[model samples]
Target chain A: MGVGPSTKETSLHHFRDPLVDIVGSDSGIDLMGVLVFGSPEGNEEKIRCSRTAAVVAECCRPDGVIVETDGWGNLDVDYVNCVNEIGERGIPVAGLNWSGTAGTFVVDSPYLDNVVDFNKNPEGIESNIVGENNYTADDVRECVKRLKIAMLKKGMNK
Target chain B: MGVQEIDLRRLVIKSFHMTDVQMGDENKITMDGKLTIDGSYVKDLAERHSKVIEKIDIQIIQPGDHDRYTNTIMDIIPISTKVLGKCGEGITHTVTGVYVMPTGVDVDGEQAHEFGSSEGNLKDMLYLNRAGTPSDTDIIISFDITFKKGMGQERHAIIEAYHAVDEWIQVYREQMKKFNGNKATEKHEYHDVIRPGQKKVLIIKEMIAHGAMLDTWIFPNEPSGVAGGKSLIDYGCMPVMLTPNEFRDGAIHSMN
Candidate 1:
């Protein structure tokens, strides 16, 4: 889904796999996901995605949420909207980020509620490389786990 | 094409639920349903398609295994045997919980996927909902097929590379043909039935019918089969109506 590799682009990428990996690796959590595409204004796809996620999030009433995007050019639109839309729901989100580093580190994304680095341990999160892929499956699992904890702490503090 | 009555006979598919997959001295499916792959079988298959495959590395990824993933995936095929007749009209015995797949790059690191190459850690890159990478319930017979450096992007080279590994499944296809259906855990049947009073429905599926990596295979003598199947793209993207049972019984498969 890119518009013929031209000036226009859509967020129909395969980040769902890694997102699935993050949630799927942890045995405790059930990963229900939907890939959202959009236009600048009112697109049916965007409305459906927003509404569907809100409904699921309300129904599941999960501990917390972790959101990330490809963060290159127009891709940031979906990421920002997902975080803010979910955050606007009064649910805490610890956004996972990838930056220029070997290990995980917290970076500034659009949503600042809670941000966790994919490659760095950050401050409170304890993570390490467990595979030839540099970071292990445990890395993804730990990041999500730490995000949930961080969100829980924020919820209590608020 | 005129209005013709397509008679599709018994398209019964059997599934032997695979329990565990291992690479050891023997290359056979045990009575206990464990898949033991002999290293020599891969060598022989590679030799047969020696023109395409420079090196063949066989690896089996089981559920709950950490730090295990595949290289770039080319195709996911189910092991099946044509018991009665040819594809689209036969009793085909197959396994459910296991998949035969090809992964990896050429001798030099190049993208094998024609459109997009998701080559990274297998655990991270593999999406569970897709074929071959089912949740903890299934096992993957991943063949790391590496081609020569320059042969990576060539269409013919890519097809040959895929056919090289498809030969492995062909062996299972032949062997499974002799399988006793009574031992099957499940059986599915397809037929071209007529409903005289009811309105008929014909569903047309436009699939990957090109020389690229994005391709869909239909009625290849097996479910998601490749070896002897015809490419839809080669058929000039023609229209073919299939019975619902044929679709349910594994007449269509994908490689995207």
Candidate 2:
């Protein structure tokens, strides 16, 4: 199958149905969505995407999003807007910008890790988001790990 | 009145074995055991009078073995006193009581080892030192009864004894708290920072017994390769130490 758009439409199509099933329609908590924005800089796209994802995830409710961006420095406006909306709702969002194909970025949450990656070109970006082409699974694991630590630290301080 | 002399009886020493292990690998070793006047005797003596056995003190003596020098540790095993009978003496109530031993006593291995000579046989003498050292020691339970035989009083002395024991336990608990250290009150800080481009690293920190911190890591990203440090003292995590106060307040707001 040909690769599809890594925009808000695609993430919604993939995640919204499952999230609805989990939270239920009348539960009053919506599973907000994630938006991945390509870095304006050439080499820093992965870092930008990761930083944005961390910030967005903190702003949103936990377990609300999976942001995917093609590593080739192209911004997805609609997805960005969805991230903003989720941010407004206080749901957390996380973004993965793959160096190669958008499908390659690792999708991770506190409870989930090493999700399905279908990208073909591993070398297309500075950092491969998942598997061998990227940093080891341990690195990806730390991203979520440190985020949780930060969250807990934030919780205890208050 | 001139001073009168009261003769004191020597408490008989009974044989006992170390039954419990407090720590380390080697388990139960037997030691020379001694018998003190069972605490129940005080209650029995007090029953003839119209008074209660408030407290009793016993001295422990070590009977030395001839073959080897033996050192023995002594522990006071408290026995529970259950209520037996209560009665009225004419117009007043008098309580009568009896005391019994609850369970066997415990002895320690060090005491047992001391009894073992170079020949590997246990020595005969149960040694008593000025220092209060305990062998395998255990608390014993005893009971008391307040009601006497001839009087009309009905409540047993054991009920009052139970109250006394309860008060004693409370006192012991307070003393233990003081000995263990002050209750932990202060908040602690934990920090971890990840630099860019490093991979295959993890950080872990936890609180261990006696409020010690344990930190460990796997595949650390730093070139120095060390991934662990602990807080100097016991502390709870707080917001200001972890995040800017404004950010923490905002985060709390978001969570709410």
Give the TM-score of chain A, superposed on the true chain A, for all candidates in the order listed: 0.50, 0.32
* Residue B119 lDDT (model 2): 16
The sequence of per-residue lDDT tens digits that candidate 2 reaches over residues A1-158 is 01111111111111112221222211222223212232221224423443444454554335334443322222333224334444455443333333344333233233223222323233442221111222223333434443344444545676
TM-score of 2: 0.18
DockQ of each: 0.02, 0.01
Off by over 4 Å in 2: A1-66, A69-75, A99-136, B1-256
Please provide, for model 1 over B95-153, each residue's C-alpha lDDT reduced to its tens digit, 9 standing for 90 to 100.
76776667757777776665445556666555443322454567767788777776767
Assess the local accuracy of residue B178 in candidate 1 as a C-alpha lDDT between 0 and 100.
Answer: 72
Tens-place lDDT digits, model 1, residues A60-106: 45456655432222223334455566667766665554332332322
**Predicted structure with the largest TM-score when compared to the true one:** 1
Output the worst ten-in-a-row residue range by lDDT, candidate 2 chain B: B247-256
Cα deviation of B150 in candidate 2 (Å)? 99
